[model samples]
Target: MTQTANRFHRWFAEPGPRPPLGTWLMSAAPSTAEAMGHCGFDFLVVDMEHVPIGVPETASILRAIAGTPAEPLIRLAWNDQVLVKRVMDAGGKTLMFPFIQTAEEARAAVSYTRYPPQGVRGVAAVHRGSQFGRAPDYLKTANDQVCVILQLETPEAVERLDEIAATPGVDALFLGPGDLSASMGRIGEIAHPEVQGLIAHAARAAARAGKPIGIVGPNPEMVGGFLGMGYTFAAVASDMAMMTGRAVEWLAALQGRVQAAEPAAAY
Candidate 1:
């Protein structure tokens, strides 16, 4: 079979002058995914970690994003091999494994994305990932197209960034501010100076390891700060966050509590 380009992998392998920006999709709605795809994001992450997006729903979401220029990334709930194989067969190319704390866990996450002598991903003769058996040479080429992104969500994880980044098949690194803050005993305080300090340190560590790093924040301002700290990619909030934030703002305006401001552009 012919090889398909994995843009997420290519973007990090040889980054452009501008860092690619993305957003999270927690609604698990195909329409929402399609709409976000058209909004000019470099990539869109279909969140399976926090949201109830099963394999079938994930397949539908992939179809929704296929027509747009944006790349689709799947954030798995955990570093489970079974979960990884299922989502990959459902057409997930770029996957983000969450809460990884050690080099061994990082290696396991990468192995889940590969098949045969390289790694152990269960094989299937017919599946969406193989174009339903149409891609005769998919087995040989899929490994090259798969992108593995490991999430460092705790102080321990951040401290081991160098070793984890050194693991083969780890295409990129993502620092989860929410979980990291909580792990640092600063829950709901991602902007706390201590948490922010570790974030900056992780970025520099990733740069030193010669790996591209990514992060997500609750707003553009915070994400902009991450970009300035040497993050190669960043995601600003999610569809649900933006929608609810606007809803609250408009309701406050209607109640005369405050004036509603113009909608901020979603990166």
Candidate 2:
């Protein structure tokens, strides 16, 4: 493992004063990757599950983040072994697995991240994770340095959260509000009273278990709300959304000024 990967590993074991803030960067564009790193976020979650980022493109994006301090995280589409190993092989140190609902899933995630007694992650230090195939201590250190985060997105997951948290090698628990709300029969209403209550309950459980929790909200208001509720890590927004929102607002303002100027000129 590289020093950067070791840093994230230490973060989990020692814990930190403040939970780092990151933004989700789903667009596979190299420019998007560079912009996300330059935006000053502590980390960036590269979306592989929903986006069309194949292995090669993902590697390029990771390279794009090389000069910046912001860490690159990949959210694998599913809990498949091939996908997990591929991401790790391609220089991914932190991974967010989706809809992990049971201890078995947690164990599987751990197994895929490690080698031997720790896991069955293929033994090959010849990837970007090993500094383009050359971290001498890669095998001995990879397991210890990887950060494994699981998404709790269903009612069943909420009920079994304690067990999941207790599962060894599970670094963090993240809440997928949209899916959680939908599972609770309140689709698209994450802020509904009952939904909020459920979130609070889960947060309390995670806090008591001493595992960091993560969330994604569009703006500071929602980010503040999650942090105030005891969530350790939070993603304030997405790269795509941030860019689109700024562009739309700027265009609207410019068009409004143009319309006003047109009326005055007609006088």
lDDT of 1 by residue, 21-56 (tens): 999998999999999999999999999989997899
Compare the candidates by TM-score and give the number of the best one. 2
| lDDT tens readout by residue for model 2, 141-162 | 7777888999999989989999
Best candidate (score: lDDT):
1
lDDT of each: 0.93, 0.85
How many pairs of residues in model 1 come into backbone collision?
1
Model 1: what TM-score? Answer: 0.94
Regions more than 4 Å wrong, model 1: 1-3, 257-267
